[model samples]
Target chain A: MNTESYLDSIRRGLRGAMESDERVYLIGEDLLDPYGGAFKVSKGLSTEFPKRVLTTPISESAITGLATGMAIRGLRPVVEIMFGDFLTLCTDQLVNSATKFPLMYRDKVRVPLVLRTPMGGGRGYGPTHSQSIEKMFLGVPGLTVVSPSLAHDPGTLLKRTILESERPVLWVEYKSLYPKQLLNGGDELRIWQVEGEDGYPLAVVENFSGSDPDVVVIAYGGASVPLFESMRRLIPEEIRVRGLLPSRLDTRTKTPWWFSEITGREPIIVAEHGTRGFTWGSEIAAELNLTFFGRLVAPVRRLADADNVVPAGRGLEREVLLNEEQLIKAIVESIT
Target chain B: MILIRYVEQSLLRLYAQGLMGGTVHTCIGQEGCAVGVVSAIDRQRDMLFSNHRGHGHYLAYCGDIHGLIAEIMGLPIGVCGGMGGSQHIQRENFYTNGIQGAGVPIAVGMGLAERFKGTGAVSLAFLGDGTFGEGAVYEAMNLAALWSAPTLFVVEHNGYAQSTPSSLQHAGDLSRRAEPFGIPVTRTEGADVIAVFEVANRLLGQIRAGKGPRLLFLDTHRFAPHSKGDDFRDREELERINRECDPIQRLAAQIGADTYEQVRKAAEIEVDIVLQELGVQ
Candidate 1:
């Protein structure tokens, strides 16, 4: 199973979404024919739900404002920001309008809206393109953030997100996760499932495998793959290690509770795809109560994009970047 | 209504006696402008956005005088639930906003929302002649016309924006300013409440009927100071204008008050009763 890719899984996820309700519709720029989107996941969506799907002008602010009004009037709209950097341009709609609506109206209204954007760093997609700005919205109380690292996980997480939550959801999908490998013998699609409250497996977390270990690494989005690959590279015997892809940021999932239960404390190394500032790294740390000793081995450390927005050249990129070796050194230093 | 002017005058008295906190932009002279427009507007189907000089607008729109008083007094029961002060009065259906041009965009957004909802509800934004120069007003006008938004832009031309007269501050004419945007414009005599009502109702009808946007410049007199503490005593024919421009006096004439004394005392009784309820002595 190429669990890394999200193409087939997302297709199945949309099918589940469409079958469950008629009100859920996708609307955004460059989503129509001749150009499915910056990525092709929405390529065939216009065909199946032609009337329901919409391709709009490049007005992010007005589009978000329109969606806010529509959501208030009982329409579930999913807006795809062409790039994560453009989310800043829609602050009037996002920060003040949508975030404050339910609280302002005292919960009489629910803005069942979703903003899905792509956040990836490997493609060297320069300054305007590669930032995991989803973390920037962590402090906002009314919004939920979901960062999925794999293709099928994306679809399943999206399906569960739409079905759940009374507030707005911000789903950040990594561009690298698209067109991932096929699962279930290359014909049938699958969703990695996690056990729900009723002891039945739910679509929140698809799979889990780790030995009894003292410390764990919790990561999300495209960065998760590299962390997983590094784990495989550093097979230190008997040290015990586990990994996490945070299914939902706004709501506490099994990750934090189980980790807190397992360690009798907070064991979190939250890695993100962008600059540490205006991001959720500190929020996660604060919530988990982990001391951020950044010397690669003291307390919990965060690996995010460097503060200065540098060019996407390989030399400058690798200098400020962290991969397998850095993770290992950090883990070894902590354990010792 | 006759009570609206009494409300403004009572508020001015409280402000002068140091019984109220914060400042009030008295609409003492422009009460007819608001009465003229809101009298013809459907309370349920139409909405009005007011300016800093919004007492007239609030009273004409049936905004609670207690809430207005509470607002000026910095009490929690103020129109914005006390979050907004005297300038930011907001009742159930009607509301005020921050700054000069902020309300215009919000009112424009409301009109847009109304359009999609198919309510046939017209939104009227009241601005002083000084506000005619605001960029948001122009932006609102352009969007309103482009969307054919059912909104009314009421410019209460009281001849002055604070101390500066419109003749010095505002360039061009109000009607001609609205003309380039294809907005139908009209001028109504603000001193004559009946004439004000006639123009207001006709324009409001077109708005509700979905016949585009209209701009009405109600040429009126400013009898009081721009604010609670400003000096605005008119020396040239001041007595005639104040005696003639009183909306309550004009309306009372039709009701046979016998003398201005009877009407004034009757209004004063109601004002005292209202002030008592507002926790004022």
Candidate 2:
């Protein structure tokens, strides 16, 4: 049985990219050997590839901008934003430079840097550290945003991004899923795979287990972990619901192709780690409504965190983030 | 430098005549910093990054005047396919960004890539005096010096960051700021192309020789206002700086007046031909 933790998988994927290509390197805060990154994702990587793994100063703007420069110079540089909240600092370079350059210059060059940041709130890291702000990057041209959950192998997805992706990739990992095993070994169901710019699969899991599904729950990243757990608790019978998990979230191409296969008036529920307003859930709902507007049984219900900054205390933090109870409530509300 | 002057002058004329679309930012008097530093550095191996006022930098390295004019004119044959205009120009190893000090850290990344590949190539970033306020520049300096990356930070200290003067912006000098990071700093006075070139050439030599990160603060001046229609500077002081430290005038003084006139005439003729080709008088 081949099993690996999500955190170890990300490290393996990084090592794979570096080992395979001399041009690929890692740059971020405390990513060097002894410290091995803030999350310990680069634990032993600096030891093996000392020169390739660089520990940079606390400059989020520089991290993104420098990686853009390296990418322009024909080097595959992956920058890790120590925390997801710090992405606000790097958005200047990420949005203005990394996203604009390739298309602005008519594809004369490509920025192939992967910005790997841990998102979502579970740990009591407070407002600055714990944030699921991937929604901010939605619809940003010339950039691809992907998140991994228990459904997809984080290592394989990361390797694909480094080795295969042409444009810039914003790879978001969650704090909760780092120590969990990927969802595998269940009854065979349809897998909706959307191929990215480089033909790498941006998977959307549609595990219905054969029976006619009454509702389809679409979720991603940290939200998917709780959604699946709630689904298992609610039902064991044949196809009362279908779980649709999409890992990629920008300028989507192939998701519409699979939309035609979902033939029913079954209510679609979009769950995410971001706050309720202006989220990836909104974008997904918009696209789904555009295609399946008439077929929808109800207005697409969205399950997400409260519209408030993530608090530091354990009890307050639990109250803000998405939980199993909320998922069950949204699912039941949509179907009824 | 002459071509840049003529092209930017034409752009201003077009803007006034309502011929161009957006407002323009020009580097009329600060041509020496762009031409000198870019000419002194390695275009084949090294990379160059610039700020908002970057027409001079583009023409200095790429020398594609026709492409630049087309870009400013929003023609389809522009350098960036009419997408980037003057502020965002991209060529082989040359890139210009509109943001203030965003290029510094990006330039650091290129320097790191050069070190990692053992290419012995240096990365040059052209920042304005206003960029001193940006914390990213210092962060980049720290990383570059800490890792000993071959990067050069060139500050075209044109006295003002937009409308704000250096004195009002900061308390002390620019060079002393980088001293705390252990990065070597060199300051050059005036906008003479020869003087700026000599200093940049020396600093670039050391950087390519693995001397880590270096900062060259070129004391230049922007003759024009910040952008197209923002005339808020002291006109008398602006005139004083221009008359005393005009880069082209300084160059003409070094070379003969006849030779300088001939160079300007040639650039004028080239600009005329490009304008004719684009059907714009």
Candidate 3:
């Protein structure tokens, strides 16, 4: 069977969007010719659409603000911040300017801008370069945060975000998942996707076909990699686990349809690659707790990396980050 | 300039009476830059971004006195439906924000967008001497020069950033700040609206003709306290500015007393009508 890498899928999605829409422009640093961006997600895009692909100076704040301006003036600008950690430099433009423009302009204008950046650690990129800091942008009012996992087609999600989303979006690509193959169901696993009302997709993975799930673990982005492994491992122990990986991460008001499909009696574990406390997992767990109040068999559990800077060494990084073992332990504990 | 003076004076009255909420930064002494630069731009196609002290800019751009008053009054009939209040106002091709140096890059982007669309429009952004402290402005200038974006960076050197004097906050001359970026810089005393208009017209003509980015530095001053009573300048110096650097006074001296009085009265009546319609005392 043929499989596509997550990185290639994202590139295909960007190329498709630029092909269809003339207004779609890519603005970033190191996005021209051979470099094709730091992660090579924008590989060959500059050559295909020369004028539309603009290689900018190392000015995140200005580029973000410039993208906002372009978006305001009826152009779709997709900014690639080489690393997700550099998003801090563009916070003023994203938070105070881009997110506030539509409402501040009394809905007379829309900032249809997309900011794509690679996040997360595993190859020992160390503290500054390898941090999953999507949690910092969680509750920003008008900004939509989406992280596509291996379970879902990364390119499709990116293309949809560029063509459809009228609001500003922060599309987080997991750096570690770049080389992973897109997940397709085999004989032992069932993989399917459910589309959200806003057009974001949620991929559901289950090991058993007919049996009811003992626990429903919800995660997104790179967290889904270990989640699928834990689900397959638990099959031997007769512990049926179903995993839900949504492309959209900011779920403050909108809950996924699968959240209602699962029985309240089954335990739900919220897993994330970032550190615990005041995070995506916390928000999801809080929402689930409120919705499944009194009906849930146990408290909503959160599985996440340790609340510390990711260490540089491979051994130490593995110990600090979330893995299949940690997820399996959390699921078993929640069910028991 | 007369209309701006009347509107700003009326806003101050309303602010003192506690009718206007939030804070107001009036360009009482810097109307020359607003009127001159705005008069030179094509408002229908070109875009202008203003800073916190933007009342004069807004009035000079579209002369929507009633909308400006209603906006400051926080009424639904305002330009931005009163959601923007005094600092944040968006009408057609004009926009303003309270943040100091945030608008520069955004304006540059608008200029680049216009260039890409072949719209023949130039983007003008206003900054203060204090805004030189912001790193984003330099980044924007670098990008604007590198990309050859048709953006005009207008610096209104009023000499103070809120309460801090420019001398204490900045080193070297403010006019030469854009020198390293290779963007051509023009300096003019902002008290003469005609002179400002001439200089701004020449620079904007170059920008519209696809000459990359140009910087126009206006040597101006603000007679009113920054954001209602934050003035820490020497009292005698302010009095000297009021007498010598007032744009309205200089224009009046040139236009003859009779013509100036007629224009002043016409502006006063217009402002009164707008204030009465908005139900502000």
Candidate 4:
């Protein structure tokens, strides 16, 4: 059997969802026609499922709004924004609208909208293209952020997110990893959990929460790899961090309660691969305070890309961001 | 006696005594437009979303004035558990918000939801002429037309937009703006409640029948200043215009003296009972 590529895995995810329900469709810029997509994860989909894959305008606002519209209208619209940086152009739709659209509608509307955006900055695209903004949306009230490593199956992650019915999800698949090999040197993980072979799994496995007796480390997108690596290196010795790869930087998850157990209202540690100011770490710390501020063990400290625009050169870019060393230091420093 | 004027009077009276708290913007002299379009709506099936100045829209839907009154007073007995106050009230058929143009896109979302669910529900968004300038409203209009969502855009053009009149603010005719978006447009006199309701009813039915997501403009007057707190008053001619075009009086006249008296007595009794209940609570 052919080993799974991230692109093929994502395609398998889309195909599974397409087979499972008629409501699932590919909607984004250049997602249709001879142009499958910027990353080509939606490749060959346009030819096979003409109506299922739709081409939208350059309006990220419109794309997300359309996704929100379609999602509530009972269609599972997987929207693609070419880069994670473009999300700033439509913060209202993503933040105030999509994030809260479910709650403002009193949970009467279930937004099964998935946004697929490629993150990381290696090709010298400069300020606009070089951002990793997953952390900026971490604390939004009703969204899920999933960034699975190469060890995790993209197809499974995508299916899980689409199958979920409660809130919208922002699935940030790494651009570099689009061609990476599968989890554990294996093919796609076959799930018999879905009731029917014909139907998609329950909203593409929105796997963000976990319960175990160890350290809770939150990571998104490509950062999951480094986070996992840091945990591996730190394990069998110093820090016993259990990596928690939340699908989105959202506030609704019960994982923060898990965080509360370790820190005891004392400052907790949040790590991000993007701008430090609007970090998801601060969001978790704030929530910790919001629920139980006075009794915290310590103040929350966050490790992020030091609030500067991501530079072009690899050396300069790496210098600015928190790598595994910095991540471990930040975590150890927080509750120490 | 004019429906809009009567509705405005009730809204203003509540505001005057500080009974209704969070920001109140009544379409006092501008009632005709809301009454005109909303009167044509089927309260049972059709849905309406309104701007901060939305009492007229809800009243036309036969909303409980006491619930509205208790709501404006910021009471828990109010519609949205005292959370929304004046701006955010979600009644059975109508939902109003205080956040300027925020309701426009939400209305579109709700409209799309209604359409997809095949609920046979036509969504109406009551925006001020001022909000027409908002991008969210235009985005909503574009999406509504693009998806053919069953929504009606009602711009209650009541002359002034909080000190700046519509003439200075809007460069083109409000109805014509929708033409570029492939949305059909209509204009009705706002002071004439029947005219507003008649046109609104037709458009609403067309929308329910999957023929429309049209925009309707009702140009009228605001006899009172923007709010009860506004020191500014309409000049003598403006004042005279409001008294002369009062809708309840006009509708009462058209329906005959006997019918008017019966409706008036019933409305008065209803109001009295509401006030009594409010007092008890």
Q: Which candidate is the best by lDDT?
A: 3
**Residue-level error in angstroms, candidate 1, position B179:** 6.4
Q: Give the distance in Å from residue A215's predicted Cα in candidate 3 to where it truly belongs.
A: 1.0
Task: Looking at model 1 chain B, report the run of 10 residues with the lowest lDDT sum.
Answer: B90-99
Every candidate's fraction of true contacts kept comes to 0.01, 0.72, 0.70, 0.09
Model 3 lDDT per residue over B1-281, tens place: 99998899899899989998998899999999999999999878999999999999999999999999889989998999999999999988999988889999999999999899999999999999999999999999999999999999999999998888899999898899898999999999999999999999999999988889999999999999888775778999999999999999999999999999999999999999988888874
Worst ten in a row by lDDT for model 1 chain A? A198-207
Top candidate, metric DockQ:
3
Error at B49, model 1, angstroms: 5.2
Q: State how far residue A1 of model 3 sits from its true place (Å).
A: 5.6
Indicate which candidate wins on TM-score.
3
Tens digits of per-residue lDDT for model 1, B1-281: 55667787778888878987777788776777888888888888676778788887887788467767777777766655555566765554465543565456446556655665787877788888888766657766766677677888888887778888788987677657888989998987786788889988888888888888899988777788878766655667567778877665676676675766676787678777878887675
lDDT string, candidate 3, A39-73, tens digits: 89888998889999999999999999999999999
Model 1: residues >4 Å from true position, as ranges? A1-81, A93-98, A101-125, A132-136, A140-210, A220-225, A232-241, A247-267, A290-298, A310-329, B1-33, B47-58, B71-96, B99-114, B124-200, B211-271
lDDT of 2 by residue, B1-281 (tens): 88889989988988888777876889988888888888898888888878888888888998888898889888889988889887888888888878888888888888878777888889988888888898888878887888787888888888887788889998787768888988888988647788788988999899888878898988888899887877688889888988998888888888899999999899999999988888887
Comparing 2 and 4 by lDDT, which wins? Answer: 2
lDDT of 4 by residue, B201-224 (tens): 788878888985988887776666
* Residue B270 CA displacement from its true place in model 2, Å: 1.9
Superposed on the true chain A, the predicted chain A of model 2 yields a TM-score of: 0.92
| Model 4 lDDT tens row, A114-201 | 8878887655667788788776766577767767665566687688778765577888877756776654522222211222232222
List candidate 3 stretches off by more than 4 Å.
Answer: A252-258
C-alpha lDDT of candidate 4 relative to the true structure: 0.67
The ten-residue window of minimal lDDT in model 4 chain A covers: A200-209
Candidate 2 has a DockQ of 0.71
